[model samples]
Structure formats: C-alpha cells, structure tokens
Target: MTDTYDVVVNGASVAGCAAAVLYARRGAKVALLERRSDINAHKVLCTHYIQPCGYPVLAELGLIGELEEAGAVRNSAQYWTRWGWIRPEDRVGPGVLPHGYNVRREVLDPMLRRLAASTKGVDLLLGHTVNELLTDDGRVVGVAGTAGGERFEVRATLVVGADGKDSAIAKLAGTPSETSPNNRFSYFAHFRGLPRPEGHSAKAYYLEPDNAYVMPNDDDITVISVLPSMERLGEFKADLEGAYRRFVKALPDAPDIDAAERVTKITGTVNYPLVVRESTGPGYALVGDAALTSDPLAAVGCAWAMQSAHWLADTTAPAVLGHGDLGAALNNYRKRRAENLKAHAHLIADYATARPFNHIERFTFSAAARDSRMAEHFHVFGSRLMSVPDFLSPWAVARCSMVNGRALLRPRAQPVHSGERVLTGQGAR
Candidate 1:
C-alpha cells in the first residue's frame, strides 16, 4: 500500500485551518495546503462578521478567549426594517453560541492559521498551488501541485476542498456547482475615530433597493458597506467613492463616515453570483465556501465557513481514521450541511435580488421590531440559527398578526360627509 495521510486539505483559511486542526486533534495525520507564501497572510474583501451560529466552533477550538484578548468585539444584531429599526437587546438562547463576533480578518486569519500550524500531526504546506487531482478508478486518491516551483504529490484517504468560492479543487475534481445571479454589488471601507458606541451592536439598514451595514471591529475602527442594486454597478464604477458616499448618507441613521478618516480605500472587485456545490463524493469532499457560498447581504458567510468546516471534520474524521463507515460518514456530512443551511441560503439568495419587502414581510419586520419575543426569534433567524419555518411558526405568525392587527386599530380621523360639520355635545343634544 502506498503511504497515505488520513486527510489532505486544500486551502488554509478559516475553513481549511479549522478542519485541519480538528482532524489532527482527532489523531489523524493531515496535510494542509496553502497557495499563499505564509499561513498568517490576511484575506481582503471579507466582512469578518461571524454570526451567533459560528460561536460554538470558536469556543470548541478554545480561541474565543484569545480573540477577546486580541480585542474581538462581541456584538448583537440590529436591522432598520422598512417600518422601523429592529433592535434586539442581546443575542438570545442560553446554552451555547450566545453572542456573535466582529473581528477583522487581519486579526482572525492569522490566529486560525497559527493554531493549525502548531497542531500535532498536521503538515502546513505553504506556497503550493494545486494544479490537478490524482484519481484512480474514478475516485480521487490525492492531489498533485506545485510548491517552490517544483511539482509535489500528497496521497490521502480523503481530499478536502476548502479553497473558497472559486475553488480550483472543485473545478479539477469535476464537481458540479450552481451559480445564482446576484442582483446586488457591495462596497466597503474601514473608518477610524468614530465616536464610541455605548454597546456593541452590528447595524444593517434596509432601504428597498439599496442597503447598508455597519459593525464595530477592534482598534476602535468600524467597517461599513453598502449593497446597491446591480443596476447601479455602472454608476458606481464611474465614480466609486462618490457612489459609496451616496449610499452611506442615505441610511436612515447614517454613520459619520465624513468625519472619520477612512483607513483603507474603498475595496472590492466585481461581485460574483452566489454559488452552491455538493459536499461529498467518492473520495473527495468540500467545506466552507467551496461547497456552499451565498449572498453576504446578511453577513452569514463567515459563520457558515467556520460551521461547515467543523461539521465536515466532526463527521469525516472518524471514518478517515478507520473507526467508521466512510460512506455513511460522507452522507451524514452532506445531509447535515444541507439541512442546516438550505433554508438560510434560500433567504439570503432572495434578499440578494434587492427587491422591496412585500406587505407580509413588512408586517413581520415591524412586528418583530416591536415585541421582545418577536425580536428574539428574529435574532435567531438573522443569525442563521433558525430556519424560515422554524422562525415563522404558527405561534409566531399569530403574534405578528395580533401586533399588526392592533396597529391597524389605532384611531384615525373619519372624513366629514357632504355639508355636515363637527358639533359640540351640547349643540348636538
């Protein structure tokens, strides 16, 4: 038998590092490949908002405290719905994943990378670009790539593609993925010296076709961005800074981007449509954005990246190490990935269209904003911790109905008919 590792992971970002570290901890010999020169290299064009759903992985990896010490800001979520702003006081639910985090990629990327490099039995191979997959009998057995300008090969029982949205591994492995059109484009820049907010809360503005999001990161800096309908892409392309300013200023409660200095120039390339790929095959699997990437309008990408990696490791590690059935392990990973994310992805894709919220949506948003219970459910739903059906349960629907129905009952002036005029009680009698 040719010498083989338990697993070989391509890419060394959040998803790749998490899977590599966890699998190594489970006593598996793992190889982690990175195209970059160093594992600590930072990724640009990322919002870095890891929602509540991703908290457990941070905790499980024991990095949450270190991140907090590194000045990671824990934040709750708020949205300026069309009717009004929906502010949830804090993240709900008790046991785990109680609060989300806002940490810049500059801080997070290195931390995850270092942890993986330090883990026992994991080889962190840097500066390697996977040129092709090695297959036998129509099943992937390993990968052949280049490192230091020379070809290299790593054989493994399982291959993991965590190379992000534009996955080279998926392309080489002949995995099928669907790309959905994105009706919006995003623009973002970081600002320094903004007046300190009293509490940590990430804010999102819903302005029909145009939307804005703002969050507090470390170093007293804030990240703010706008998602304008794709129809305005050409307009933005013509004058990027001016278009960005216009959208920021249009926020119902606009931030003072004018007063604060921009730390980085407005950053982004052309927006790509959402992509979803199947998670498993005969000998290879995908994790994170490589498997499923959707609109970032709701800030769910980072969280999902952490989660999918953790889930992949949890299911596949035992089988890869000869403790379980490989087929069943792969299937479990696939189902869990789909069951947890399918509905959330649907909602994100729908919102990516940049369409105005309809009446029912408006009512629900308004109601969720007004009541604590509704706000709690909204918090869970927004964090991708709850599905649409789970969030809009019959009881929840009834509550929204009651709240909106009562809102309609507030007194309003009745139009006076023809010649009739208002009269005092005494005169009428």
Candidate 2:
C-alpha cells in the first residue's frame, strides 16, 4: 500500500523534525522519515549551543519549557583572541527570548523528534531510507524507499531534504552544491567537575591557526571542543587525548584539570567542509546542513538547522496549503535563507581557513572589546540576530579605524591587548 502526504521530509533529525512539525501545525499532512530504527538515536558530535534565533521556534513548538526542565543551560559567549577576552555585555538578563540553550544533541534531538511524531498531521516513518526520487514529467512527485527492510513508496506534493551534510535527497535529486575546503580537525568530549569560566555559559579561545571552546551543558557536564589546523592532524591522530587536552589545557584561565573528570571518549570529525547547496529545486526544498553548512567555530550549526527549517516551512507552508504558488514559495525560501546566512557564511568560511587574524580583524576585535556598542553588535552578530555586514557597518568601521590608527601612532597605546584579560564581561579590567 502507498501513502501520500503534502510533504515528505527526509531525516527526522533536528531540521527534518522541525519542518515536519511546522508543516503539520499548518494543517498539511506530513510524513517524517528516519533511517534510525532506535527511538533514542541522536547526534554525538555537535557544539550543541542553539543560537538566539532558535528561541522563537522553540516557543512556537512549546518545547522551551521542556528543555529548561531537562536542565538545558542558558548560554552567552565570551571570546578570547590575542587582543583579549571580548566580553559579553553587563547583563545576561532576559530579553524577548531567553539567551539560548546549551544541551547535548543526545538530549535535544530525541525531544525534537517526539514533538514531530506527536503533532496531529504528521506521520513518523521510522527505519526508512530513501533510495530513489519518484519523479513525474521532470518534477519530483514523491520518493520510493525501504522501511524496516520492506519496499514502499510515498507520494508527496513537496520533498524536503533535511538530511545532514551528505543528503541523499540532494544527491538523488541532483541538487547543485558548492563546497569550500575546511582546513581544520575538531574533537570534543564531555567532562564533569570543571569550574565554570564565569557568568558566561560558554567561552572560546582563539589561537592563530587553531581554536577551542568550553561549553557548559546539561547535568553539570561541560563539553570541550578544539579545532586545530589540518597540518596538526597527525599529532591529534597520534595521541588524540593528549592532543585534545594539550590544545585546550594550554588556553589561559581554562578549567582546573585537577578537579574535572573526563566522562566520555574523545570524538570528532576531520573532513566536514563548508557546503552551500541550492536550497530549492523542482518540487522540493532543503534545510539545515543539507542546504548550507557553516564553520563550527561560531557554533551556528544547531540553531541554523532549526532556523532554516522555520524559514522553509513558513515560506512553503502557504503554497502547500493551496494559498500560494509553489514556485514563488520555493523562491522565497531560497532568498530568505541566502539573505540571512550569506554574509554570516562568508565570514565563517574565511575564518574556517584556520589562519591568523589579519589587521582588520584585530581592529574589529579590539574595538568590540573596548566599546560597549560594538560589543553589543558583536553579540547580536554572533547570536545570528544580525548579519555580518550589518554588524560591521562602514561608519562603525571608520570609528574603529580611527581609534586603532591613533593607538598605532602612539607607542604607549596598543589598540590590541597582547596578553591581558582586557574584557571581563562587566567591563575592561
């Protein structure tokens, strides 16, 4: 027997589940397919900080409270460059939305899938993997695949490729994608009893050609991630624990190793590149890493997944509900995703090269550290609330340039702090 739905979403992970839920809530019948037969299947390797942009969707899904109840950490970011710790603002106070959530994907993913499964108009298809696109006259009409080792077909008006970076839907449908080479190796593991960095829920250390993160997560466990230059891969592969610990422990003011206990095996990825896929194709749309994959330094992956799903669903839901043109809706989805993520993705790609910060980057970082307004703008930009271009305006650049230029002219005034902790979140100390 064949089943049909308004939308058949591939990969019932974060992005796919979000798309399925949104579509179902809009009264469109949706089928969510997941290849994982285990009900508790979840992602193991992720930075796990959902950016501020994801809050609205979590609220819409009514899962924010559930997340909090599950011990999700409220997060803010403090950055450490050669200049100093570019601190967050004085207040981590509540805003239109809570700051953000820091929870492991192991906890977050299943919760998201449950929401999709329980939604009224959504059918959850577990243990299903798409093998071929069922097309008609050049338009994708549905998909045929195996579910629980049995062959089956499902027809849908629109297909969504929310599969991870390597999307089967994109491959089968011939979705055009551009790939940017990433020159870093990343590994992360959980630890308990580590002292918190401060009021900020997460902190990043930026060493030229390498970076590391300390993320406070649920159950009092902290996740420490390190990304080193590709040339250093052998060192990591040789003694991963030694390399990972050496990379993170050497950072200034890091956690007390004497007190913390390594709670999990070191896990990581080496070859995930920056991929920008054509977001919309004939009779279909893509979201999450499938549509656009960014550098993980900014920790935007998780939230981008949820946000892209929201964008696709909001833009295409009208058409799926018979109130708008499908082509126009798909176009809107493509445009919106590009409009929001293009500038951000460009900056990430640049940073992904694992090179030292140039002069302009130093100026920007120092100015943001020295000034509250720039710091606020940086916060919004890093939170994915503002675009990179918007965050670095020409006027703001001129002001920063002047300040940095003056400092350069005077020997006593160094615009960038070399080793001092210039920012402490409250103010420069």
Off by over 4 Å in 2: 91-98, 402-429
Which regions in candidate 1 have their CA more than 4 angstroms from the true location? 1-3, 90-97, 412-429
Residues 113-210 of candidate 2 have per-residue lDDT tens digits of 88888899999988998999999999998988998778989999999999999899999999998999899879988999887755545888888888
Query: Which pairs in model 1 have colliding backbones?
Result: none
Sequence-dependent TM-score of model 1: 0.93
Model 1 residue 160 distance off true place after TM-score fit, in angstroms: 0.3
Q: After superposition, how far is residue 346 of candidate 2 from its true place, in Å?
A: 1.4
Cα deviation at 375, candidate 2, in Å, is 1.9
